[model samples]
Target: MGNDGHIAHLTGPRRPRALSPLREHLRDTFWFAPTAGLLGAVLLWWAASAVDLEIVALLQRERAYGAVRELMSIAEDAKTIVTTISAAMMTFIGVVFSISLVAVQMAGGQLTPRVVRIFVRSRITKITLTVFLATFLFSLLVLTSYESESSAREVTSVPVVQSLMTLALVGLSLVLFIAYVSSTLRLMQVGPVVDRIARETLRMLARQAPGSEDGGDGAGVRAPETGWMAHEGRAGVVRDVHVARLVRVARRQGVVLRLIPRIGDFVMPGTPVLAVHGGTPPRRALLRYTVSVGVERTFHQDLGLGLRQLSDIALRALSPAVNDPTTAVQCLDRVVQILAAVVHRPLGTVHHRDRRGAVRLTQRVPGWADLVDLGLTEVRAASVHSPQVTRRLLAGIDDLLLLAPEERREPLVRHRELLLQAVEQAVPEAADRRFASHPDRQGIG
Candidate 1:
């Protein structure tokens, strides 16, 4: 239906389409209101600038505003002013392009606001660059150098040079952005960690419920053989998690849940939540199975949603108790695999030695290892194994691998050899791992 009480009767009474919340809110605000007020403001400014009207001259200007009017002359200069505004728009676009370059450089958690991944996927840099180029051309061709007097005062060359510099920087930024975006995409494509985890989870549930076509996608399922740890409370972070209870609905459908142990405690791979008593739960129930286990509260809501439905169906067939240690280890291995897949430079490449004889790596963020109960791998990976740079150091401080930005070249290359020695013990494999695609990979970053 149209906005102004226009009713269309076709196929059953049609409901009016409502504006989205964001659009409706914007419509009510001054920022998005109609342009009548803005046009009025522009006309008033023109009147004041044209006649040089003082507080008491409005009546006189109105009486004599027609012949040889200053307003007419000012109106003639509108083209120039609009052109200058276009140039400013160009500069804003240039900044966006520059930011795009920075974004790609830090695609893998190197930049702020982890949500930038969507921006990268949107190809915003290309659109921004196009806008910038169009604005630059318009400003250069139609805005500047419109003067008629040949004897006019000489204009400073600064603005011209600044425009050229802006174009050059934007060009360079585009090159860098393309390179980093490609690299990041390659990394994500190569790492199969997330898919592997999802598949394993489905398989585990399928085994417990035999003769059930509840695999959802009919993908072959297998229970986790290793790397699974059972814990008593929730498994992952609860802050961002979405949970719902399906016990009542599931029970009505003949779902049987055999509480394996303490009912209130969280269950891991080794512990079972319950044995299915009746009909299979829907696969959607798997979504709510996200037990808080990791140190970080990053409970994956999407992962939960996808798995829960399949879990529900599996539970009805042959609900079995969860008991597997391999699941947790598999998760850990997935982390290592993902890191290895994305890293182009050896771990040694990014390390540096400071004046205080300390090794530094800027991006030393540890993975989600605290998912297990024993916390054995988490402790080893995060604490001891991480800090130990070498079996031997100058004074027991192995070389360091600082994961700082590439822009900070001075601090990194200043003491390369010293830093290498410090990190040698910590990452012996890094030395052999070649950053480049060669026969024998070189050591750490």
Candidate 2:
């Protein structure tokens, strides 16, 4: 993807949700779960102990039936003790849970998955200890309630109810928290994969620029479609230019390649800055076939490919003659100027088939052969008049003109024919009309 497309994907749109108090409570109860559970157990034991013996079982024990009955009666009488112990359990649970929660919040809630798993595992040990403690407390409470009969029985249920509610809330919260942590980690992994591939693809597209030129050495300029082979590999246009400047020019751009050079040491392209390694092969394959195909088929092949071909041919033609990179760059500039002139000229004629039809360029320029001859003559004269411009134009041409020395002219003609064909496809009506008017189209040139 391009830079714009990547940014758009990452920061897409907001999502909607439904509000609920249960969900809100669960979210807030990360630390309260264990505490609530313990408190609830304690309160349940107290309530059962505080009830009358006649209300539970007549002789709810063994050989000490009289004693047990009497103790049970006393426990029922002292309901205040049961209520007080239950309230204390609830308060203890609440304070401990609150403190744990506050500590977590203060630590910025950056608990890792491993840490959470450890806590969950430790819960088993914690639960075992709490159960033992609850059993002992229950036994002690029963004994005390039996001994303390004749005191007033207090009626209270707020602690028991609150503790039960807390248990439910905390359980739900932990489940949600685990899910959130898992999802967040997954997203973090996915984000970098997307970004890396996207940036790399964008760089490739930029390197495959349509209108850009790479000037070489002195020679007559040719067009881009002259069958020049790709050698330097591909990179983004901006990145390529930046690499060139950083390596060849002084390192003013901070291109980020780590290799340092001696005063006279030679520099190379793949010396770290241009090379990327160990990318996920599948992602690379997908991008190569799908994304690159779109760029070439839609943009490069239709609009830019022909131009690039011509530029390559022109560069090869001039490379051997020009020694200095600056001179070569100048040569490419001149050729681009010449090509620019032809680009502006209508490659085809536009006519309205119907009033409602859109106007478009057509390939049948009436006297296309004559126009091309005139263009060549004009550029040749201009080249002679302006030596610096000519040199630059020739330099760009030389970079691409080295494919086959003897077959240069033939390839050049073929390249122009391809452009003409492309222009015809771009505007078929003009071509059809021209063919109908002059079927042979033989004497025009």
TM-score of each: 0.23, 0.19
lDDT of 1 by residue, 1-445 (tens): 1122122111343433423323322332333222443343344334433333242145344454342233334433554554655557556655655765565555433211322333332333333344344435434433342333221122111122223333453465466456645644542331232343344333322211111112221112122221222324545322121111223333234332222222123335456433333235334344244233333211121222212222222222112242222232233333333322322222211111122222211111111111111112221222212222111111111122233334323332433343344345445565432221111111112
Q: Report the alpha-carbon TM-score of model 2 versus the true structure.
A: 0.19
* lDDT (10s digit) by residue, model 2, range 364-388: 1212233233323233332322233
Candidate 2: worst-modelled 10 consecutive residues by lDDT: 1-10
Once superposed on the true structure, which residue ranges of model 1 sit more than 4 Å away at CA? Answer: 1-68, 107-115, 118-382, 387-445
Maximum-TM-score candidate: 1
Clashes of 1: 80
Candidate 2 Cα outliers beyond 4 Å, as residue runs: 1-69, 76-78, 105-117, 124-445
